[model samples]
Target chain A: MRPTVHHVAEEAGVSLATVDRVLNRRPGVRAKTVTRVNEAIAKLGYVRDISAANLAKQRVYNLVFIIPEGPNSFMLGLESELGQAKLYSALERINLDILKVRAFDSDALANVLDGLDLTQISGVALVATESHRVQGALARLRQANIPVVTLVSDVSAAHRDHYVGIDNVAAGRTAASLMGRFVGHKPGKIALLAGSMLVRDHVERRIGFEQVISAEFPELDCLTVQEGRDDAMVTRSVLADFLGREPGIVGLYSIGAGNRGVIDVLTSKPEYGSIAVVAHELTEHSKRALREGVFDAVINQDAGHEVRSAIRLLKASIDETQVIAKQEIIRIEIYIRDNLP
Target chain B: MRPTVHHVAEEAGVSLATVDRVLNRRPGVRAKTVTRVNEAIAKLGYVRDISAANLAKQRVYNLVFIIPEGPNSFMLGLESELGQAKLYSALERINLDILKVRAFDSDALANVLDGLDLTQISGVALVATESHRVQGALARLRQANIPVVTLVSDVSAAHRDHYVGIDNVAAGRTAASLMGRFVGHKPGKIALLAGSMLVRDHVERRIGFEQVISAEFPELDCLTVQEGRDDAMVTRSVLADFLGREPGIVGLYSIGAGNRGVIDVLTSKPEYGSIAVVAHELTEHSKRALREGVFDAVINQDAGHEVRSAIRLLKASIDETQVIAKQEIIRIEIYIRDNLP
Candidate 1:
């Protein structure tokens, strides 16, 4: 039979309340007593029944996920995954609440962060819009001892406890490498499409993409980037206009959302196959495009993984438990038609 | 407060013992009483604390992992992951035992399975070697009500409860697609390497690789496969012989282990960069090879993910619980130099 707290208390020669205080790291416990309890626990090989302890305490972690509200398919998919996570939230003893703010609006994001009830919320995760005001709000949360995690887009400041997303710069470099290889020896201009440069992920992706294109693929020239606000309609018009105006366009790299727009324009063109396309995120539109030989590659970060990792990190912080670092890494997933899903 | 069994029993006008029987699906409970208990549970939104319940029952799952004993880096890595899992086993109420048999010895594997004490083992997981003898053993286990999970490699017979691995056929096709694109328009032979044709994963990969090469890349010809038995010495000698005799080798596809030999042979040749290389399973050797430009790409199924998934599947099978399908999918991860992690 496994040892229990009673065994630990008897071995430590302490009262049950004293053992409990040491186990929970509560105040008013002397260092000598805490050491005695810990030695007894280690010697007895007593693995704490965390679930039973939590049940006894009725500890419910109140976690909030703050994401951008937009027409972006990827963000919508993230929200959908959070909705799915809610089904299992009760079993995990987590009360998950989602807050939506205007996309890329630093003032709105900061306002939302500043207005949070610190006492009610155990942790916070947000798709950050990098700005001084937002950084100040994050600092305030840190001062209040609330753990903060950045999801999807991370901030430049070091206020967050953890970042549960892929390395966007590496993702961009990978896209560039694939693009360079796919459009081998073709001397033509490459068109770059992004959601907005205001976000750190987009800017980092652009930097990595441009670095590779210039360093290796000298035959290809990158055209000026056009911001489409991640909207399908706006991206479609921007891409259509770019294609009409630019000559010798041989490659297209969609750094962010608005792949639906890129696909629409490419499919309607007669010489679509000549232009190698690489995009980010896998949605129904991108998956179909990949099958139809429209998009050569898609870079993805699993939204389910990110959401689940965030929850685990928040819970671990609240519990003061160790987490497996490797299991939490959000990999940069590269998908082609042959290896979808 | 979260509802307890007493609350459920009170709401249902039944005894606590009756509620326990219904919750645990034990026999001797009337259908009407079960319905009443279930209704009360639903009305109270009672989510069972599985860890606490298991603690109350003092349930410790004894799980066995059977794998082939070899110098194969991937399998070694899998074993290492299992070793790491052992550290957390006590906390999880799991007792993990690893059993090793001779590599590619069907009778040895079958004997190991046949010799298991079915009464003590809660579940079994194995890296399967498909054969009639093994199939019979699996069938006997199934009849004895032992939950079994196939890990890394799957068996053709449907005796196993779940397969915790990636689709090998799709992985092969993905390799072929990448090989064809990397060797664009080059008319030459492509060398195929495998551990052995005795395993199902290697055979399926060969089929998918050939299918794509014949249908799409007409310029490239697939050479006869070399069976290295996943040994470094055997692979090095065989590949060196092939390189000496075969003319105009433009690409290489490694379907299984023994990548250390491939890297040694390729690195020795001055024209290594001329050949496009794609191999399976990322290890220290493959990772370094990729960084050194010796490997164009590495197709990987995370060993850690596979091991963890197998454990989860086995436990869920034992508990008769539903698994999150999306979370369990083992993806065919494509790694380039830029995105190593």
Candidate 2:
């Protein structure tokens, strides 16, 4: 028995239009409703015949991707992927509309969500939040038939259709394992540079990082986490202050953006023989630092894949296409100087 | 006046159907024709009116990404992106048909290219080679009006519409900078590992690495370049031999695939306390070694973005749409344990 749209709508306790929106990831649905519908779909295991379904529907699947706004290497990388995607847009059968949002603005995001054109977009892929209005708006959109896929961060209350990014906690664990291995059962002072606690991705990453550090690298004492907020200025100040004060710090882990500051602190003044440094995102700043021997390691998630994946899922919903689950998963990339592929 | 496909075809000296095929990235035609068409398009600066063209034509963009085969983590990551793209395909108003070819076989790829249904697809994206057949096939497609974008390693001879990925030379330079900085201005021996010299990306990376090392890292001596061909056994044996002979080797720069053997060799006896290591791609082998500290850094290019970008460009050709250049570029991602986002 094939699971029809009517069945999905009935299971989700929504109207037919609502099901259409949810499946297609259309705008104007509440987050809560979207989750309920997704939950229903997961339970039903509904799959569509993409080619036939799309041919019948005119195949207009418009999805939006909201990325954090910053000049940091990671954001820059994300921007590059998005630009490339636009150059060779993956979905000609559907429409992928992109909207870039400024980072750390909950109210602004809420206001934007309130005013988004519901008729045009099918779904959204965004770095998430824990705000009520955000959740409420998503719920409304869901009721209206729009689906949402969280990127980089999870929006738990909204319960979006899917998440198209890496597992930060696992990435953290991987980071810890690397730190343990490279440092080798030796005890030393390690400093951590975090971007911000405002974003869910950063917070989760920190949690996972701390967990791994506690379990594996206990011999190495960790310095207090510095809030860089992905700013070069703040990162420079924080790192400069730490390096000056804690000359004994032999290892460093910067979980935030803006490696230019770290590079400045490490290479500008006279330094010791060796200090193990690890950070995230392979931006120009970080990459240059790695080449210069200032940064030790970089852990990364490809922003381009996440963007493309989010759009594809939105289209599948709208087109009623069969999507293969095994291929959509995103993984973490770990970088070192020797193996820079 | 806006340049049209007609202008491009006339400039390229091909038939209207060939121009249409090239503009739409449709299959068929010979490789030489495709190149001539591309050159014509370049000469005429004929950009498609993607939105209107797509709305009018109802075109479907199908892109094929040929990556190295087997359980390579990076390749798997690319595969995952393809899967996810299928799920959210509705948003982009297109369809992506992805096929994975065996690794390191230019002839095998040429064979696969020969079997493609040119009329059905809008374009083709491949990690290419300078093979005669591959070029001929591409030329024919161009003549038929099918847009071909090279993924990862490019096909300059094929005159691909675009190369949707990072600059390997820059990546190598970046790697060298990191290696120099991490090792400090100390005299030490460094080992180099790679998959093959057949790849332009690898060659460029090696050149960049050597260029920087010789120019800047006078104290840090590079032993020699070893070709592993992305083979695990070969890398393990090579690394073991290198480690045994070069006891003073304090650094490793793997510019290729198959790092597991290297990891296994390094971790077997635990002589990895101060051996600074750098590699490319964040695979299971690299990830495990990174966690264990057998490796120090990784340099990565997002395969997902490249695949998606290629598909989008193809679709745009079919739809005759405008592609935003800023959105589709793939960037390098550097990872460290602390900032594993």
For this target, which candidate reaches the highest TM-score against the unseen true structure?
1
The sequence of per-residue lDDT tens digits that candidate 1 reaches over residues A107-171 is: 99999999999999999999998888999999999999999999998876488999999898899
Supply the TM-score of chain A against the true chain A for every candidate structure. 0.97, 0.81
Task: State the lDDT of candidate 2 residue by residue for A1-341, as single tens digits.
Answer: 44667888899999888877887779989999999888878888775544445445555556677776777877777777777676455435445565666777776667677787888778877777658888887787787788888887788844688888777777766666666655656788888788887777777777887788888678978778888878888888987887888867777887868788888788867664377787888777777776677776777776766776777787667555656564467758766665454
Best lDDT among the predictions, by candidate number = 1
lDDT of 2 at B88: 66
DockQ of each model against the real complex?
0.72, 0.10
In order, what lDDT does every prediction score?
Answer: 0.90, 0.74
RMSD of 2: 9.7
Docking class of 1: medium
What RMSD does each model have against the real structure?
A: 1.5, 9.7
A54, model 2: CA deviation in Å? 6.6
